[model samples]
Target: MEYPDPKRKSNMFGKLLMAAAVTALCIIMLKHSPSFSTPTHFSRHEKGVTHVLVTGGAGYIGSHAALRLLKESYRVTIVDNLSRGNIGAVKVLQDLFPEPGRLQFIYADLGDPDAVDKIFSENAFDAVIHFAAVAYVGESTTDPLKYYHNITSNTLMVLKSMAAHGVGTLIYSSTCATYGEPEKMPITEETPQVPINPYGKAKKMAEDMILDFSKNSDMAIMILRYFNVIGSDPEGRLGEAPRPELREQGRISGACFDAARGIIPGIKVKGTDYKTHDGTCIRDYIDVTDLVDAHVKALQHAKPQNVGIYNVGTGKGRSVKEFVEACKKATGVDIKVEYLPRRPGDYAEVFSDPTKIRRELNWTARFTDLQESLGIAWRWQKAHHNGYSSS
Candidate 1:
């Protein structure tokens, strides 16, 4: 048996007190933190849906889906407030077709009951493609009330209007973030959703509410939980606008443009030294074109029993470092990179299990790979230098 030294005991006591204080502080912070709180493995067919109402149709994914629907000769009507979506996207659509009666856009917020009523009155839409939710994970984590109000409550309003208007089918824009940190790699539709952030919780809540509605009403819904949606439209007419959170992602395109202009600062690598092969967070990123194609299918063939979930992603995973290197090769630039600590709440690896869509919808991703997709993104970004921004 040994006696504790007085000095050592004092130091140990002090350390324990400090640790306790820190833990208490953390507990208090978590308690005070603003908080907020899918689709299936299958989709099917219910015929006779012609007119489609695309909420947030002016947004990146929604706009692309709108364009695809129009090309397929489906009458498309868009409702967007131009909050995150760009008016420029609408103008581009107008310019691209230059034809009347293909698509209609209404600059209205669904949060407004009057606007919802007006839209319902104006068109006999058979289905709706909703992409109107605020999506930044960090933002939702900080301001959960905002996320709940905009995505959940506002979405409830939209659904109420849809039910009133007899719109029976819905294709929801869900997120992989709803799954939070996965227990396994390449998360599947069956993965238990344990979202760590309010944004994810809100999305999950919305899905639950929609399902609850289905139990009562004659509603057919397809929930698509998308992983990372990267790349641009192959036509160069559509692409993701510059959002504050994804500025670094935009930098890949910017670096490409700069290289094309004979200047090169390369790219910035935010984090590295993770468990991934390239020591960075790995994610499954799908091309936007492929994503839009999947939406088109969901819209075309959605049966009552088809109300299920699908993971829209390239089955393969790519680390952030790998993605940047691919961007460099795609742009033919030896991009420079600087590593920092991993971003808060960033997972070491998260990807999708896309087998359900492949087996059920007979839909598999086609067209560009990551490198090729980045090439297209680079082109579109360079072409539309200042035409749009995501605020």
Candidate 2:
């Protein structure tokens, strides 16, 4: 302003140029830095390799799914925050598939948009199998917000990344709890979803978001609504290993195993008078092996711009008393069962029709025997009494 100071203006322009040059140099350095470099072992566009992203791949079901995908020769990148997932499962997978370009584990949370965006930007994924969510029904009732954020909000983040990256296929792991004590016996795909608990409600919300997004996009989606998932990897490569703190809210099989191992005094059988064949509630116990098979079949059958929803179960319901008897026989332990009052948000009976999945995907539960399934899981439990922590 003071008679056009040319010298000051020249110095200011020089400083601005220097700052711009430094920023450019820093970006170039970061791109070439080893820590920021892209993985060289695998390429997203590699020939004859379908790179699939398995969210929450360190968890029980997700880990098993990763094992199946790796065994089937698919390139897998596992992203998990390890909140409820075990790092040992990921280590096992890495050890099993030590070969480069076979498997990779990323310790990152989907809630972080920057981290998720970076993952999608770096890897050219062909498909995404989203298995990340808090699944405990009792816990969800106590902490509804955690379920909503982890399940529904995180799913939205995954979907957003998938859309931005142009990923075409998605296989979502849903649950039959969304049916919420339907008046019917076997639940079908067309069954109305009236969830009772926060867990089921959050999962249903995610399902709705996916459905609505698919209506406007070319994404191929398969939502597998599973019943009670039990058993292990069948080959003993992976097993359910929930944290000890969550034992009370964990799976019934886990409680049975704990009692058999003397970790817990005895099993607390909640909800004894649910108007079933016996006093206990009824559920369709599907083997984890068969459950993973359904996912694989879904991935294979997914079509662009199409949405397929199917219930994955044995199409038969077993009472809780029957399951306890089976577990007792499987573990060879008396496993004292103390009857308790009904837990919140528990349905009397919930199973699957499974007709649509069988007809369209040609998938069926091969391990329909409840005792045999429990036996398979018991073997793993006995071997690793401390779960994956000891291994």
Candidate 3:
């Protein structure tokens, strides 16, 4: 015992040398690897510039919002999966804002928590405008689970990432569908959220989650429950370009445009027997330009520890027949219309009471003329007949 064990001592010394060698190798690898280096795109963030994340920036509304933010000198980063969005839209933005640090696009699905976490860790975001979702009401009815997973679960993931990263501002793109056939006219913020379809239910669930989260956190939150969004960028830069396969379940504007362009033989009016003035369903059609204006206003008014819920729509309800006539007049095409029975779960009429938004946000639907709005959107559609595929 006094002499000690030389063999044991030698073994311990050998192990120590091996450990040091391994540690040195790891350090060398880390220093030389590009993967471990800071991302160049993130390094371009200006010191005082506010960076906004647009979740579905490749889609119609999200793209317009990004354009507005860029024009206002705010840094914009668009993250879209391109599942239902167009790469062409992203390209258009990039072309418009070619300067570095002004705009960036990340092709990522928010459903992936790990990817979202990576995005948060890499970049500094001042706010998030969440618009990525499967928005087809008919598709939501047939495939309820898809809507819940895409809209509800994905929103939760984004919120968690934002909270973890301490991003305090969020502007959620909600739909008027959450009101779900309200008993009264001009649905307000107080409308009971008894959603009728899976789309509305999923959005309402997301809204509830955001509200619950906001109660304890100091995050600034704005939920814009908008009516049927129509029109385009007004500058003819962006427009609705839903996939051809989804035409049957797509928006009425797209169907009308398709019929006008002769892509379809005629447009089908799904609800003809509703108890409206024209015996068809009536809806508040808000132009995309006005909708994006509301988003910008909401962002400007956002404050930590506060929440704003507003209905972004014109306080006027237009019937299906009226909209069709406007569309025909705008396109200057005698688009044949085939009237059909009312679709299930459809409300007779759904409009919004924009008094609160007007009083608070100081925003109103400037492009209120239905024919004018349709005409502007039709101009973009006529130019991009193939819908970004032409680009």
What digit string (tens of lDDT, one per residue) describes model 3 on residues 1-391? 3897999999999999999999999998886554676666553446778899999999989999999999999999999999999999999999999997889899999999989988887788889999999998888988999999999999999999999988989999999999998889989999898999999999999999999999999999999999999999888899999989999998899999999999999999998777888898999999999999999999999999999999999999999899999999999999999988877667889999999999999999999999999999999999998999896
TM-score of each: 0.80, 0.93, 0.92
| Candidate lDDT (C-alpha), each | 0.77, 0.93, 0.92
- Cα lDDT for residue 319, model 2? 90
Q: What's model 1's overall lDDT? A: 0.77
Runs of candidate 1 with Cα error greater than 4 angstroms are: 1-49, 243-268, 388-391
Candidates in descending TM-score order: 2, 3, 1
Q: Candidate 3, after superposition: displacement of residue 53 in Å?
A: 0.5
Residue ranges of candidate 2 with Cα displaced over 4 Å: 1-24, 27-43
**Model 1, position 106: C-alpha lDDT score:** 87
List clashing residue pairs in candidate 1: 39-308, 39-309, 40-308, 40-309, 41-309, 44-301, 44-303
By TM-score, the best candidate is 2
**Candidate 3 — which pairs collide?**
none
